[model samples]
Target: MPALPTVRRLSLAGLALATTVAGVSMTASAKPPEPAELSAAAQVNRTIQGMSLEEKVGQLFVLFAYGPDAHQPDARNTTLYGVASPAEVVAKYKPGGWIYFDGRGNVQNPTQVATLSNQLQQAAIGTGLHVPLLIATDQEQGVVTRIGPPATQFGGSMALGAARSTADARTAAAITGRELKALGIRQDYAPDADVNINALNPVIGTRSYSSDPKLVSEMTAAQVQGFQRDAGITATAKHFPGHGDTVDDSHTALPTINHTLEQWNAIDAPPFKAAIKAGIDSIMTAHIVVPALDPSGDPATLSKPILTGVLRKQLGFRGVIVTDGLEMAAVRQEYGDAEAAVRAIEAGVDQLLLPPAPAVQFNAVLDAVRSGRISERRIDESLLRILLLKLKNGVFFEPYVDTAKAAEIGPAASLATAQKIVDKSITLIKDDTKTLPLSNTPRKILVTGWGVSTTQNLANSLAKRGAVTTVAQTGAAPSDAAIAGSVAKAADNDVTVLLTRKAWDSKVTDKLGKQRKLVNDLLATGKPVIVVAVQDPYDIAYYPAAPTFLATYGYAAVSMESLAKALYGEIKPTGKLPVDIPVAGEPQKPLYSFGHGMSW
Candidate 1:
């Protein structure tokens, strides 16, 4: 989906749905009554003392709110998001919390999300002890946004890094948190503390703030303050001990970091340490195994030494420790969900995130306690931490959110702020020929790329600037004939602009190799070939010969529009490189430094 239309359409759909399903029921009047005057610890102790074994177990597991396979209009009957319905899952497992995921087809917009949260909370309130669910999601604004449309989307961590403004970081996070809070979400798994040092790292690419631990540390701390203090939402510093240095993605298989303790402390551990000192509410464990931290090669999620020893005792982190999804292969391949859950609790993780089989995991932990394998005191400790998070975020007294207000907030103020930040994040890698700030004179322009929508938007923007533009929406590295046809048409244009979207290529095939060849082929022509990297800035390493190169570090419509404005000298390019782009066969040496950027 195009970035602009995605937000606009999502907002409209969410508003319409909110009017139909939510209506006045989601107003401030729906906010739950304030709990009795008692300290958070006192209330948690009282609640825990009254809870049953099943209720306590339920509080430990955070399951996906909707079924994954539920394709029907009534998704509650599907088995993908665990059980038949949200109410059914709550009643059956008495889960401590639920997370919304769009990948499972259970999520649509902010309206449906708010309604679902309210419904899930109602079910949890009806259960024994009536503890509110710890509603959460990966609302990491940039690439990993769960709640779509209507929610004001920002340029994420790398963009913040390029903007290099702690004030902007805090403001962006605050906007994200405010929007999430409106949708009844209390916890944000964001401000990724991972310092992306390895260029080949797949998952943590733009999600990380910077390669510099100092920058990542300051930005993450600012993000936490924005989410917790400004938006009144619990902020979680994630993928702990750093998932940035390793090339392997934990989502697929277990990744191990062999860096020594000294290296880890210098590069990866500083951001997390800064987050802890910034008074972060939660810390999420990575699925990767750091051999330096734990010699057994166990994923940190399942390691007692890393979770309890390093994070708890060594770092002096006192907040809740959450595990990265237990369903991930990093943990699941070695130990099943049930065994993993038991071990994770034993590892001192306060919350089990997205266990595939919540009931089995719950039962396994329950049985472990019964068999004296896992003590009741341990469970109580986790429960206290969980309850403390809810209380700290005001989840108990104000779980229900004003959906109408939420619909108004994200789109109204966020888009403007996002545009400014994204504009600032537009990095000029190499403008040797000074082909940018294209003249206002009428000229033929050939705008072609596999990323169709963004290129199309760029074409339209160029047309408005008096350049007669033609678009060839080549889907994912066009064929030889297609490239020839595009080149033939480019012969008619004054300048050829090729937009490429590639962060990391698959191990199976060099997917971006074909695209790189196309750019080089286009450059072979006499016309100036301007390469705009919409996704990853590292693409310039492949086609450095391109006369002009720009890195937006994003492909959103706002980013594209900002690029267009910069091209016309309306918005001067100000963004710097957030990560080093290594040349071929030189992993340690970078063609461009971290702060490299130039403008006309």
Candidate 2:
């Protein structure tokens, strides 16, 4: 990556404030096309002019891989392409991009990641046209983060949204961009623009910034500016027109969202519009079916009316349209991998991300163009868009990044800012019994939870604040005997603090039921109990009658520290709920609505 000039290296928050006060006098949109853009456009036209049918089709397929390594001999090697070394796959197939996935088999340190990126770029350079690969990953931060340890870990979208400041959102995204750029990754499938109105939305719960469309729009726009302008990386606002309203995870099953165009316009479409106005690099297609857009019930990933008509014509987003992973059950169960890949391109998606079988899908798309099923002109159009994105980001000029900088940039500047975000996002939903501040007059405190570290952190913090603190990790969703023993143990303390974490998936409802019973048993003891939900805010809805409740939105280290402070009353709990937590059966009746918070 090209090193930015020191004069232009103002922190993202400072740049945001400066732009706000002075009225955004300088921006990529405001300035004329740089020499790089002009050169890239000419180069793309020239390259496209000379490409064969197969070579042009290759530019549309962006496959998934773990790291630089080949697939091990195991049952898990499911993809048809890239079973060998990634470099060999690139040399053979010549893909336009590569998507990195973590935790399966390939995990590397920061230097290793930088080296792998260099290897991948070199492989692309070896191929004809030398179009630098668009290397990307799910660097959405918080729990969904891919590259880490060396990379700075910030809170997710909901945590930033709780702060209710665009500047804060900008800063968080900019910092994330800086870290990603250092690692030689140019594209981030992040800043989820989904308006999480449904508390039961499994995949998008804490990933979404807020349920309020206006706030989601503003924060998403700020994040786009931060990632693009401040970090010089491409930002993709995803799961359009919105994936937040559905109760199902697209990875598991096809989810249907039955919103009229009026409702869609009001809630789901605004953030994407704001993202487009902020000049986002791309918009990823959701697999969910929206009956309002396409009555045929086609998922957005394969719906021409939705992608070409609504996103392209209505929203006017001309940058690029990328598809979510095609292997996901939402699309795979309905359509074959190769068939879906071809249809996705026909439906107006510029990039096909993470196909189940890359070679088969690539050949299917190639065959489509050759047989006139997909016109050569269509192939050329997508090729130009892909090449132009490469040029716009200067990936052609500086495909490899500084290994030393990759190791050094993220941590030194990000810790304090991350801590501050966590502090501002810890919401105190209720303290009705005045259980908070935990009675300063020297009392025994028992911190018990499913998470050992969370319980220990609270115990440690309380111990520092003059209370004798003890902790127990009552094995998450414990059995009746385990729950009974933990409850009996809790009776020894003057006050009991229960740390709870909830999953947004309906499958976990049974597990939450078990945890709820434990909470009920704790409360039945008649000892003052405070519930700290360190993850999903909806945990409060499951245990509404707890004496006091707090929501941290996540369990990042900073969140834990900030939560401890909030518990000890060292800092006031000022954070507000970014989403509504409705009653279990009734979606309209919220136990604690958005923006609800309390302090002692």
Candidate 3:
């Protein structure tokens, strides 16, 4: 006697059996598949077999379109893609995935995002292969998070680094995944695996967990567990072969990673290795050139030696390999839109993200396959991985999210956990004058910073604690009048607190100089000047003579509240430095070592 599947059979001799497992179907001529054979691979393979060449090519690229409404066509979008709307785009290309960009109006709120996702799926279901698209967004949390308000804005990866708790990493990823699930988002291009060694790294500073490779690896692995295993959403570890050490932005131009093979193994390999071991669903390739990896001047996105030889063969990564934005200058300068797609596929990439003209690229790849420039077998290899991702992400069964439930599961749901992360992450860098804990009152406190609204909110937090506060939004490189006004307020107030936002990394002309003047001006007013760094703890390195200092990894709502609480001793500072704050004029010695923190 053999165990039979809990499925429906229509006839005895020639029954059509419908299985709950992966929606598998059994024909009358075929015997039931073994338990192992009944897994999603079989169904995914069947899906591949049924797809046409056009559908197959479409599945290889993750494209983007304009407008908040999926059904309503934007005039520019129609002329560009020749597709009336998102639904029209889906029906035309039969793409493998779609990326959500907030600035492009692809996402508005939970309900709107959910509607967009469902409409995209509806279009896919109505098309050739009827395969659900793998939806993705850069919800990296903290600084680079794509979805705003209503979405739980956890502190960035650097905050996670400061907390020094892998448990927090997992929990944060879980909470983020839950919210994304509510809105029908299935993939997160996050848990940036780049070991941010460059202090001047403009793009990945707050995004990378830490400068320490081991710390980054631990946090990366734990986040994978949180995102994929616990939260049930696909998590992609990105900018492969390390985008962390470069000072230049890959979006604008190509950056070179000048590490030797041994150095690369030490700095850049740990986090990606950890990600692979933890079973990350996808790995996004960088657009940077690593001379040691491939001396051919090819970025990782189109480097066979990097993507196929190193990541696939050396690292033994069997999951999907996705290219970072194809429209980015790093790749565009090297190859045209269509040629890059062909090159990426040949280089062993599974998904092409954000091609400028998706249709043009799609047709190019299709033509390549027909001309034997790319093989159909290569296409299936990538398609199989993507289909598995779809399976793991639950597109086969739970294709749509309950739009009503998404509102309840919005940012409010994760506020507690978010506040907890920031609370545990705020660090008291120094207190030269012992002016900390503000003595319960300070006649009046002036909270002046870059963002008018952000500083006002911090002031509001203080006022709630029975302290009178004034706020000034000193725009970057504050004018002489703004600085004089702040000094005058400092004279009126017992304590003047100045907030700095990445002042060290400012590209604005003499931004750091103006800030120093403002700080020294406030100090001259005979008030206990407290400098609070709202983001990028390194701001204190420039102001060594400051009376007091605090580091909140981000300026999110929770971070602001936590910063205020830490100032007045309402909460203890528990954060540690995740990266070194270099001593000015001495890059060799740091003003503060990694994990350095002074707690009360």
Candidate 4:
């Protein structure tokens, strides 16, 4: 028989027919089935048939740990705040999944994380569903990783891509997965497949692999495979369609990508398509607007044309589809929370990620279903997918991690692996005229900008080789006083190294106007200012006159250490620009271009 029409599109009589059909199947089943004998789909269907409207609705919404009111104790008797107790909300709502955030005053430790995961799973089973709940963390690596303390910190996606081969990418992902799995995290929302088209993109700069879709695809697939294979963890290829080309941050507001569908297919979609084909378990939708794909101008999270039409129909993705945090400004500032949840689900998102409030959002989904705005069958479709994930991961049979075995894996092994990948992936973009390898003799060196202080534990690795003097730059205003002081000190020494952080892109070009003027002033003083962009490659566009320029593509400690070593000739500048740096007035293209690093 043909499937009944969706509830929203169906009349009351149609609903009656659909309900009757569903009831008949349940009534026909006489005996209780064994857990091992039940297929994941059957288990999900049976469970869904038993849930109340409220419980079914609760399964669709994932609450944010850092959102306001998230700390309040849930009526379900689950703990709600801090990394040590993340499962409290999950236990309370029997939520389909958990979305992690770096809490304000909570420190994340392995014991705490393991405890939380255990509790979440215990809670899911307590619901009598006998299914494991999804435990997700934003371990995007580089700037967005949530696991801190003893966990190894590698440079983000950009630095990993800067490695000479895709093997390094795989190794990095393996390390990420090992640590996350050790902590009992089953899902990693990572392997950002966004093509870094706009240098000004604030969030994606270091998080993206490279501007080249082919390279990103290769590296993304490698990382996904590594995460799945090494850790037995499900990996999510994220910000689907793509978020790399946009100039705005979705957390603040919605940014529009002007590319037509054809352009998107050629440049932005390859990495995602590649990852999906490689069996990536999930894909997270972006909140940005792609007018060509969805002329409605709504963010992709709530756009049916983009989610169902393009991603599902054209791309043939059968895995779960998760939305970026619904509390982000893109959704909350406009549609409000309840409307956003409805639209996201109606648009085909299986999970409403990081909802502002789990209970309120859960109630809203139920209201939508009861009002016939969203069909209960639609809810079942998503629940079945979630259950399938749990089954595939063996969550039903073996839900808890062996804490004793976890202790054996230890943080030391993972840290060593992370350090190795970080060391290998460091790229030295430029050391022109043999200007690097500074004399060991004490020299007056000036270091300033984004990551100058070695006091930060994260900054210690980058300051090992230099006699560093930290200087600060005021917005759009050159530091004449500091620059003059540094120049005078350099005149008294054999060599003067002026270190400054580079700008990420054009949208924030004016923010670095002061630093640009400082570089020019240092150059005029006849001093070779080796400007190392300790962030993204976009910084090169602002300082064309610097005699020696280097791009490290990240701000991670190891990346900083690599930059410092490359500066004084202790190590050769062997890293290449992973993306093109466009010239001034010539389309503002990249300077050294992707794969153009120099080796001594």
Q: Which structure among the candidates has the greatest TM-score?
A: 3
TM-score of 2: 0.90
lDDT of each: 0.78, 0.79, 0.82, 0.68
Q: What are the runs in model 1 whose C-alpha is more than 4 Å off?
A: 1-41, 67-82, 503-512
Report the lDDT tens digits of candidate 3 across residue range 1-600: 111123221221111222222233322245664444354445656787788888888898898789887798988778768877888888887888999999888878888888888878777777857578888999998878788887887888999999999999999999898888888888999889998877777778878889999999999999999998888888999889999888788989899999999999999999999999998879999999999999999989999999999998899887789999998999988787888889999999999998887778888999999999888988877877677677656765457767788777654447877887778898888887788776774468888866676788789888888888888878657888999998887887877779877676657423658876787787777878888877677778778778689888787776788888888888889899999888765666778889898877
For 1-600, candidate 1 gives per-residue lDDT tens digits of 001001111121222222223111111222222223223334555677788887888888888754432122334434544556667777777777778788866577666667667777777777766687888889886678787666777777888899899999999889889888888888999979998888777788888989999999999999999998899888999898789988777889899988899999999999989898888889999998888899987899989899999998899886789999887888898877789999999988999998877667778999999999988878877777677667667776456766566567566567888888778998888988878887787788898875777788788888778888999866555678877878888888898888876624535223646677678788888888888887777778777678799987776677777888898898889998988889855788878999999976
Ranking by TM-score: 3, 2, 1, 4
Alpha-carbon runs more than 4 Å astray in model 3: 1-39, 411-413, 506-512
Better structure of 2 and 4 per lDDT? 2
Alpha carbon deviation, residue 63, candidate 4 (Å): 1.7
lDDT of 2 at 471: 80
Q: Estimate TM-scores for all models.
A: 0.90, 0.90, 0.92, 0.83
Tens-place lDDT per residue, model 2, 1-600, is 332211222232332233223232223333333443344434555677777887788788886554445322333443465455677677777888887777754447777677778777877877766677898888888768887665777768888888788998898889888888887889999879999998778888888989999999999999999999998888999998799898788999999998999999999999999999998878899999999999998899999999999998888876778899888999988778889998999999999988877778888998888789998877776776676676566575678887777778557569778777778888888888787765468888777776766678667777777888778777457678877876887789888888877733437643747778888999999988888877778888777678789888777666777887887777888888898888877899877788888876
Question: What is the overall TM-score of model 1 with all chains considered together?
Answer: 0.90
Which of the numbered candidates is closest to the native, going by highest lDDT?
Answer: 3
Candidate 4: residue 561 Cα off by (Å) = 2.6
Evaluate model 1: give its lDDT. Answer: 0.78
